[model samples]
Target chain A: MNYQSTELQHQLAARFVVGSMRGLARRRFQRLMMDIPKLRDEVAFWEEHLHELTDTIPIQQPSERVWQRIQSRLGWVQSKTETTSKWPWFFGAFASLLLIVNLVMLIPADPVIAPSIERVAVIQSSEARTLWLIEQREQRLEVAAVGAIERLPNEDYQLWMLPVDGTPPISLGLLPQQGDVILDLGTRIDLAQVAALAVSREPLGGSPEPVPTGPVLYTTDLIRM
Target chain B: MTTPQTLERDLQQIALGDTAAFRRVYEATSAKLYSVSLTIVRRTDWAEEALQDTFIKVWHRAGDYTVAKGSVMSWLISMVRYRSIDLLRNRANQELSTDDFDEIPATDTLDSSLDSLADSKQLRVCMDELQPTTRQAIQLAFVYGLSHQEVSDHLREALGSVKSWIRRGLESLKRCLQR
Candidate 1:
């Protein structure tokens, strides 16, 4: 009802996120999120802010059979298992290509166009322990996990370049769990303008979309090396 | 404990029709989300069905997930809870009362959820500041999926008073959280 008003929008959004706005009112709010940008933002704001309520409720792990049934429902078990086990070699070959490319990029006489080694970042845990070591050589970014690392079985840690201008963080690529991997540093990255480097935990194949789908786990200022 | 980023990444993959990522998402979130469903639907079989439906919807709607709405876990939990609520309503319409439902067992583990975010931590501190009854009312409405009338019945308060308490409590919570 009359969601056009700012106060009403916030109230409706809040109620929707908190799960009190039920049945038809909830459906209307969902429609509003799609049609109205302001209303969408308001709902997003409430979802982000009030999410702690659900988050703090104790975590309950579902039974293992649930996963088996889900896998069966999706028909992913047999074929997907084979697919994942075969991909590590591709990553290895990709890592080798980066070395050759780095060598070739440095050989060109055109000093002006050739990218240079500019900066490095060492992402550490909250306890001040280094987690990943990053170096930017020419246009290629390399990341290596340094300290004791615990990898989420089904997830990948993704690297991001944060801009100082307040734009959303840009994905650099997935970080290697065991060894260094060459990253596809997109052309849009400006070494001079980049404010920081951050890593987020993402799914195994990495984020399908451009934006980060997860929280920034580790962040470190880009220090010119 | 599943990180929000991991869930987000999986959701993104699932959106693009990655079945592997969908499985991973289910593995990471199903238990916690199932617990939420179980708490509401009060039957493991029904909760399991709700959990399955939730992920099916998640696979189809992964692209719709956005950080502005909340962390990936919150989004997943919301889907599960809503599905559980729908199942609960369906059963309620069929049965007069399910008062003999078994009680939820206390959690023994101290697993950190997506709520470990600074935003949630701050919200928790603020929530601790709310009056016990106000907090309970909000919890009943929110976590239990109880409506105003149901909350009034549980809290033994008038409908108008329950609505006002929850409304004002939420307003204060929003102010406190923003601060």
Candidate 2:
């Protein structure tokens, strides 16, 4: 198969743009495009020609925070932490004191944390099959999957906390498919203020972003125990 | 909907690192780009990530755009679609896969409007001429990013049959588009 063949170029470009070319072949095609400008032209031609297919897909508006994230990432906006505080240490100490008080009242619980648990969540399927059981134990979470989670071999399930503040969800680590597992609920959130807990299917090792980067599989309310 | 000319101007301003121009561009095109990303990725989280990455690229690689690239919408759509596809590949990577790959990636409905929006346009005219199954295979391939084998499984046809449909369908589309 000659890489320079015009017909092959056309077929590959069309398939690449139409999205049939993928995996190792897709990577190889991309590498070939660097050496062959004509391949790029073919891809661009296919892109332009087949682009009208997108007009058929309806518009789904992005959340406003995407713009905010872009602005922050581009250094167009000052990070909230970068703001000058008149009483930085005082506020920090006050926050630490509040955290200490909360921790003192609620000791960190282990797997048998039923009595000390403050909140709990159950991730289930539409069939009412319990997929995961979560217990909020002070600053840590105890997550247990009732049974095996039949997931893609390369995929994982991540727990996310939907904030009641209407901000973006905060990742709470990957969920286990079997047995009991404890998760750290980081100091950034208060259990009582959380709106809900969600499980999203992510690539293995979980999402790299500050938020989930996969389809939200199930959402359940955090129940106070 | 900002005019194409305005979009070009926004891209130029973005190249100059102007945030206001970037916002204007985001306001105008983010929805459409997000929609395309979601339609392909089928997840708001990943779609949002793709949209964010696309805009980040738009901000830094604004100089990449050219009038020859077609409209700004086309460029944006192409950019986000590729990003969304990358997410799919990262998760599935089933391009040449033949194993029982039953994962239908997208959840969005893909009922197209070509029949109503069909004009004398070359692409539309040619698309209408395709066999129903061939057109459907192509649509499933493009919209859901399904591979030949996956499309075969989706449409319940033989793998060889689906491959032939796509090969011939693309040929017809190329001949029509080129003309």
Candidate 3:
């Protein structure tokens, strides 16, 4: 187990780099490399040697929504505070003031704010299981799942907005586990003479197949709002 | 217009809890990470989830990054690779049949600029020196993230043969690059 023999160590390092080395020997080698400067250098050498293999991959940009979601989840948009003073008290008082002002502003606003009913449709499977809900309002279409269905391991359900004109269904992105996921329907889709909403099971990430192999779990007619 | 050194410096700032640096890191590497994730997971949603999870992990563990481990970009790629591997491992359980190991259509071409990087250039030269079968075996293992059994099954070669090919191919690569 001498960590210093350049020849033997280099061979072990090469095997480790290619992922051919496994079991306790690989784990021990990784741990040993973490400590011995010479072993670390050898491992890095392999990493450098094999690094270009990654270049064979083409760069792809993910949807912009990814950034938005990351920002929202990380609370990155929240205001930053730097004052060392008893700022909690000051913020609490300021929040209370804003609340009072909002209450005052709402005193005679409206007794019954209309629940803005829009044309909507809920697509269900042959078993009458609701899979997705589509709503048209404010010149936009919103699509979401009906309930929290347990996601199958390595499978995803995608919502497609199909138009009556017999064109291909536009992907609205992956369905959420909960909450109403809103989508903007541009001029590309016609609201009138709209066909039924459909759901399809795709690979883990979603449909790479232009045509889905999984059955259409649900379809529902769109009712006018 | 930032140089790689400058990018690494910015990433170091991110490691120190700088939100601006975090945004910069996301801007710089999210797409590349997403491509790697999507290739492994083969689904958009799961790839998105992997991307989210990887970045979150990066945020929490940025402090753990050491210059000694590798370059900032390599370290980041390793994080994506590890997360994708975990996803792949879990997914592999459901679709583990030998029939599903057929050849996947090649979708994207390799970037030549990355080929010009000093380290990548060295790797390219060494990889080019290996036998075709051995090269494919190593690429399937590292790039496609296939297990040894998967490689053996896909190549229709014995499991021992696949192992030896990878070991020998990497050894040759190491020696060629060292020269």
Best by lDDT: 2
**Cα-based lDDT at residue B123, candidate 3:** 70
CAPRI verdict on model 3?
incorrect
Candidate 3 residue spans exceeding 4 A from truth: A1-39, A77-225, B94-99, B102-120
DockQ metric, candidate 2? 0.25
- lDDT tens per residue, model 3, B1-179: 55567667877787688888888888888898898777667778777767876776576567777777678777777667656765565444443455455433221222233344455466766766877668777877777677788778767789899888987877677668668
Q: Check candidate 1 and list the clashing pairs.
A: A60-B31, A60-B32, A61-B31, A62-B31, A214-B5
What do the candidate models score in CA lDDT, each in turn? 0.65, 0.72, 0.62
Question: What C-alpha lDDT, on a 0 to 100 scale, does residue A135 get in candidate 2?
Answer: 61
Better of 1 and 2 by DockQ: 2
Please give, for residues A166-188, the per-residue lDDT of candidate 1 as tens digits. Answer: 78888887776654445645576
Tens digits of per-residue lDDT for model 3 on A53-162? 66667789998866765553343532122111111111112222332343245335631221222466666666776655555554455455555465554466777767
Give the TM-score (0 to 1) of chain B in model 1.
0.81
Deviation from native of the Cα of residue B148 in model 3, angstroms: 1.2
After superposition, candidate 2 runs with Cα above 4 Å error: A78-225, B92-112
Q: Output the chain A TM-score of model 3.
A: 0.43
Of the two candidates 1 and 2, the one with more favorable TM-score, higher being better, is 2
Clash totals, every prediction: 5, 0, 9
Using alpha carbons, what is the TM-score of model 1? 0.55
As a TM-score, model 3 comes out at 0.55
